[model samples]
Target chain A: MNARLYSVVFTFVLTTIFVLCLAGINALASGTIEKNEQLEFQRSLVYVFNIAEDIDSISDEKILSLYGNRIEEITGDQTVYVVNKDGSKELAFAVQSPGLWGTITALVAFNEGGTKITGIDFVSHSETPGLGGRIDEVLFKEQFRGERISSDPSARVAVVSGQDTDSKEDARVDAITGATRTSESVQILLNKAINSVLPVVREVVE
Target chain B: MAESKKTVFLANIWKNNPVIVQILGICSALAVTNNLTNTLIMGVGLIFVTAFSSLTISALRRMIPKNVRMMVQVLIIATYVIILDIVLKAYLPSISKALGPYVGLIITNCIIMGRAEAFAQSHGSVLSFLDGVSAGIGYSLVLLAVAFIRELLGFGTVFGVRVMPGGFTPWVIMIMAPSAFFILGAIIWIARTPIVKKK
Candidate 1:
């Protein structure tokens, strides 16, 4: 009985100390961590709007300066980031929606007229690493660029792994090979962003 | 077992190698071997955790109660893993994001627990740290070999740079988890053949 009770007490004390150590480190590093996350989000916005041609090669200092100089941040019903591209202002907003494993947050951008998609970027997602997670890759996001979305918007972009033999010109993007669930989730979120978010974005831009 | 430091380190690196011989840490070996860069990062992270945890466990071995020793070792190991995760997130966010849940997945890796129980519990701090580091390097060598084949075949690229001829086609099978199983099996077979012959 004595040894058993001692084991319990020993484990309790050891666990407490170790957890405290982790908590202390996390507390100290939280500020820098928050700053890095914000920087990544800003960088994603720049990439999504195609403000910087090569988002992968840009330096951290360059990203900060470019964001400061070009991008405008505004919040009303939802937070939005705007950048001037070609001639007029282009707006990109964060879309939080459900994914296969967990919440998927994507930043989608539209041209000044709100009829064509400028580009899209994933801010965060909880999906399988190699398979579903390819949504963040350049090939997937590249498909969204320059695709038209009507103001009334009956037919929008369709993500298909196979062929799309349609009569009308539907903006079709290729789904990732192995990640069918993630591709479907992305399709659902894209439609949601169109039906719900696009109207407010159009009103704000125009 | 009054072992020399040189013998101890060399044993973990080759003869008593963790991955090839003991067949430990195969979970990460399979999971992160698809690309060279992620595997390198995972290897370095494992080294950092293993070395420090071994050092810590060995240092505290005398003080820990015999009945609760495993629990204490786990606590020490987990603390270090969380610290590594925090450091990665703060300074190297892109790599951290690329690694994703794999950073947290290091906790469940059997290599750390194995070393803690086998070497650190009986050995001195510095020798245990050396053992941990060498074991990690051994694991890394095998992972890098597997990743080399996987990345080359999967994308016809090395470290994200195009290496293969423009006309060459990439094999899609190399991009998936099952490919790693095959490549790793081959690696173990080749690596062990040498040791078996020497014996």
Candidate 2:
């Protein structure tokens, strides 16, 4: 065999064997990976709905149980998760908004009337850790819990830095310091969620 | 051969450390060092990829055509990295998420390729594996040190546990990528002083 031809053949053969091995491994792990993702999404749903306490400490089975018993998935123009809370129906939906580095996908919940946010949990984001990534911290997400959403589409829920306001009616939350772009992204994200997705979700609920 | 297994292994950790000496893999060293947990996981992931890839490359050194050896080494390295990513997704979803693209980026870490081309090409499988592991450890040691400072000052935490006093002011700069450069530079400077003096 010519040396060049042999090299090419060897490379091709090696690539095929490696790709096959990767494919086999991926196939074997895909099921568990999918299940893990599904469970994570479910856990985030349960968290955003505020149906459970200390969600991090709860077992996977408990989360599955809570999701099963309390949450109902409604697929319409937008997929929404509905949970009956204290005799009132609340809705939660996934929202994708651009962060500094990449997309920030969050599960955002709304109150029974869609007038206020009930809770929020970030499903995935690529923001820099300890800076923009602080958006995932409880201190940041907790501000949205029961925060009033303004009727004004432009500034539905204001995420401002150095704000002294703590009133839920103001719909304002302090953004993480040193993360100005991410803070603005959060404001933009909320504006879109409130102005666009909420109406569609409300229609779906109706 | 005076270059025994111990020297091959120990050289990478200190005398010829990948991060501080050879200066390979500084990209990930800077990128993932902001958080201790993430840095630790990244270190382990890099070690896993480097060790296996080096072993595989050494085992096939004779068979790999010299002209196409680099391509073959990359294929082997990439296979292990993807497998690590898949396993992490299946069993450790949260860490997997935190590490995110850095796991996939392990294929591009220069340490694995450097070991493959420099040491593995001429070494035996077991010795090459040791070289790979030690190189990874050398890289990890520097990264973890950098992360320890960053996480401690930036988040007032160690491995996510709050360790600082209640009023300790967190330094915002420490949380960003620039801080890694300063820290890593200082580490390299400190680690190389004695070696430079002897030479």
- CAPRI docking class of candidate 1: medium
State interface RMSD in Å for all models: 1.6, 1.0
Q: Best candidate, DockQ-wise?
A: 2
| Winning model by TM-score | 2
Give TM-scores of the second chain, every candidate: 0.96, 0.98
Instruction: List TM-scores for all candidates, in order.
Output: 0.93, 0.94
User: Number of the top candidate by lDDT?
Assistant: 2
Residue A93 alpha-carbon offset, candidate 2, angstroms: 1.1
Expressed as tens digits, the lDDT of each residue in A1-206 for candidate 1 is: 58888788878888888888888999999999999998998898889878786888898898999899999888888887888766788888989889999999999998787677789898999888778988988888887888766444443677777776242235777888889989888878888888889788778766
Candidate 1 residue-wise lDDT at B144: 92
Cα lDDT of all candidates, in order? 0.86, 0.91
Instruction: Say which docking band candidate 2 falls in.
Output: high
Once superposed on the true structure, which residue ranges of model 1 sit more than 4 Å away at CA?
Answer: A150-155, A164-169, B197-199
Q: Where does the lowest 10-residue lDDT sum fall in candidate 1 chain A?
A: A164-173
Off by over 4 Å in 2: none
